[model samples]
Target chain A: MRRVAITGAGTINPLGHSVQATQQAMRDGVCGIGELDIRDVERLSIRLGGQVKGYDPDSRFNRQQLALFDRFTQFTLVAAEEAIAQSGLDFDGGLAAESGVVLGTSGGGLNTQDENYRAVYEEGKNRVHPFIVPKLMNNAAASHVSMRFNLKGPSFTVATACASSNHAMGQAFWLIRGGAAKVIVTGGSESMLCFGGVKAWEGLRVMSKDACRPFSANRNGMVQGEGAGVFVFEDYDHAKARSANILAEVVGFSMTSDAADIVMPSQDGAARAISGALKDAGINAEQVGYINAHGTGTAANDKTECAAVSNVFGHHANEVLISSTKSMHGHLIGGTGAVELLACLMALKDGVIAPTIGYQEPDPECALDVVPNEAREASVAYVLSNAFAFGGLNAVLALKKA
Target chain B: MSENVKDRVIQIIAEQAVLEPADVSMDQSLSDLGVDSMGLVEAIFAIEESFDITVPFNANEPEKSDFDISSVASVVAAVEQFVAEKSA
Candidate 1:
């Protein structure tokens, strides 16, 4: 297996569109949650959500590209453009044609689906939009990215609910390690702010009526959010040969299945993923200094994640500084792991750990020091980002200082 | 429809659109207050729920609205007209 390094990254999130702006917002402890502004579904009780503001799809793609891609795919393409520019790789060159593209998304083209439904049902229209098929599929985002950059190597979209991005990133890391591709553009995208998407979650009954308060005593449920985070992963030596800027090393990745309830999370499942990543990296549990938690601000998730940490690290759990960006950005579903991983990498690079905002009162079940509300400067060598999704899917990624 | 029914419908539209009680008047267009045609559809939905009446949309009508509906008096007249037609 070959060592993989992160060459570039881009994000379109609530804090801001660029990666720098997002990190600053995290350090400043700004909350992006606001009242929902989606069309036609205002009567729903759950009104608060974190939406990516001021995004113009017209600016991202040309008319021809827009006709074939969905909104999620458009987000992927836009984010990938930023990442590709940062990597300084020439996509038209043969080198990039062999490179691959893999992305993850839970609600792909949900906005398009809702629109199509309304057209057929409410408007009494029979003919569907020509782009409906391409817009509604999970793999469309990856396909669009590959075509946009002319990448020819293995490419696909991973769908494991919230853990989708972790799975996508993990697969991309392995592709390079296995010598299948020298470079891979991998990440996740989500646009669940659409009225139908919001209404679907409303049926789940797990979304908070108020704001997201992760690991807080007053926490009710998870808050929905939308965005995309993309990364360019290349072979360490390949990046060095080209004098590419290395952000952080993708040390190891591990995934596990809960094999139990579909909606409920399990500490054992999460612990197994942590242990697997540590084993893969050949690092002791004590070597890891920080954790980017999959803290969804829900009653069950925060407690289960804490227990999972305790089960894996034992006494070292207290020494480790943990935080959740979800408290600031809300839960971005498939995009959460990618965004949180960037936070972990930034923490390892800059030594400034992002805060878990809105944590006023701590839950006794969650005993770890969550670095609440205020960003703290700490020495971090190895950081782990955890993404445990619905249906017991768990994925973990470890990033080391480059 | 009775004047009280018209008033109730107008009140629901005003509240749903986040407008002031006095801002909504008869002959005033809803689109001028940033409530576009789709917003008007949602406003009608809310009003229907509040008044326990089903407000129907004319399929042949143009997508865009031509008037301003900022004041309650004007909105009341529009709802009254729709209600009277439905009953007839």
Candidate 2:
């Protein structure tokens, strides 16, 4: 099997609009979550979220492009542009045919759906936008990325809820490793902070009204976040031969389903994915120095994830520094895993561990050494990013230093 | 109204546990009836919607929560009290 290398990375998450800004924010242990400013904010009991602030879509896209791009797709395109630009690859000839795009998103064109639904149902409108279907499709982001980059190979979208990005990235890594593609632009995007989106999640009663404090004893629940993170996954030889500036090596990826519950996470399933990634990467548990936890501040997720890590790594679990950047970025749902991968890349590439901010108290249930409250400088060779979604779907990616 | 609340609460829990109302025992804990964390949350939501009264149950720290969910009887009793208090 061929190796896969992450040649480029880009993001427009709540933390920052660029990879550098996001990384700097992570290193600063900044909290990007705050009072959400979106449509129907007054209707939401949970007012806080990680909405990408200061984003003006009109300034970024043309009239024609803006008509076809939803907020999620817009975020994806912006991030993909950065990733492709950083990789310094112009897909013109055979490279365009050998490259592809795979993205993950739970709600495609949610803004369009929310707007059109309000138009027809609330305002009693007679018609909706003609491009609504094209703009709101699940694969719209991937399709646009493929079209923009001239990548015609194996392009699609993955929608595994919160684990969407991990599953998508895992597939991209496999495609490169298995020689199905020489390059793949992969990640996820989400813009579900609209009134309808928040209204639906409010029904679940798992959303925090204040902030997301993962692993904290007094934590309430997760806060919804929005944005996208995209990366260029290239064949190792292909990248090296081109003298590309490889960001990090995608060593292994593993996904597992709980098959037990629609909402509750399973420790066994999560452990299997964690250990599976380690085994797939041919690395022992001790070799991993950092983990980007799927630490949704919800009580069930944090405790269940901690238990899974303890089960897999045992004593090494306490020694390894684990943090959930979700505390900083809020929970991005389907786009979360991709944004959280930034934390893993920081660990492997920059030797910095992003802190799990908002940790006020310690819980015995989560006894692992969570790098809390502040970022820590740590030299780590191997790292893991975990994303356990609703519907008992769990996806974990293992990364190594370039 | 209290008795009706009890029946409704038990029915919701039973449905979440995938058990028939006849098979559900008031004395049984939710765990004993196969109601995991997710089921318990769903049960809480159902009870809230059914009675129009919010149950102060926190899935993270259920013990610290004001609501009691140790047993079907406890859940029914809690719902009954909330319903009566709301009506009063």
Name the best candidate (by lDDT). Answer: 2
Model 1, residue A167: what's the lDDT?
A: 94
> Backbone clashes per model, in order?
18, 0
* Deviation from native of the Cα of residue B46 in model 1, angstroms: 23
The TM-score of the first chain in every model comes to: 0.98, 0.99
Estimate candidate 1's alpha-carbon lDDT, on a 0 to 1 scale.
0.83
lDDT digits (tens) for residues A1-402 of candidate 2: 999999999999999999999999999999999998987798767789998999899999999999899999999999999999999998999898889998999988898999999999999999987899999999999999988889989899999999999999999999999999999999999999999999888777788877889999999999999999999999999999999998899998999999998888899999999999999999999999999999999989999999999999998998999999989999888899999998888888889899999999999999998998999999999999999998999999999999
Listed in order, the DockQ scores are: 0.02, 0.37
Reference-based TM-score, model 2: 0.93
Per DockQ, the best of the predicted structures is 2
Query: What local lDDT score does residue B73 receive in model 1, on the 0 to 100 scale?
Result: 57
lDDT of each: 0.83, 0.91
RMSD (CA, Å), candidate 1 to true, equals 12.6
**Candidate 2, superposed: residue stretches over 4 Å from native:** B1-36, B71-88
Model 2 alpha-carbon miss at residue A148, Å: 1.5
Q: Please give the interface root mean square deviation for model 2, in Å.
A: 2.1
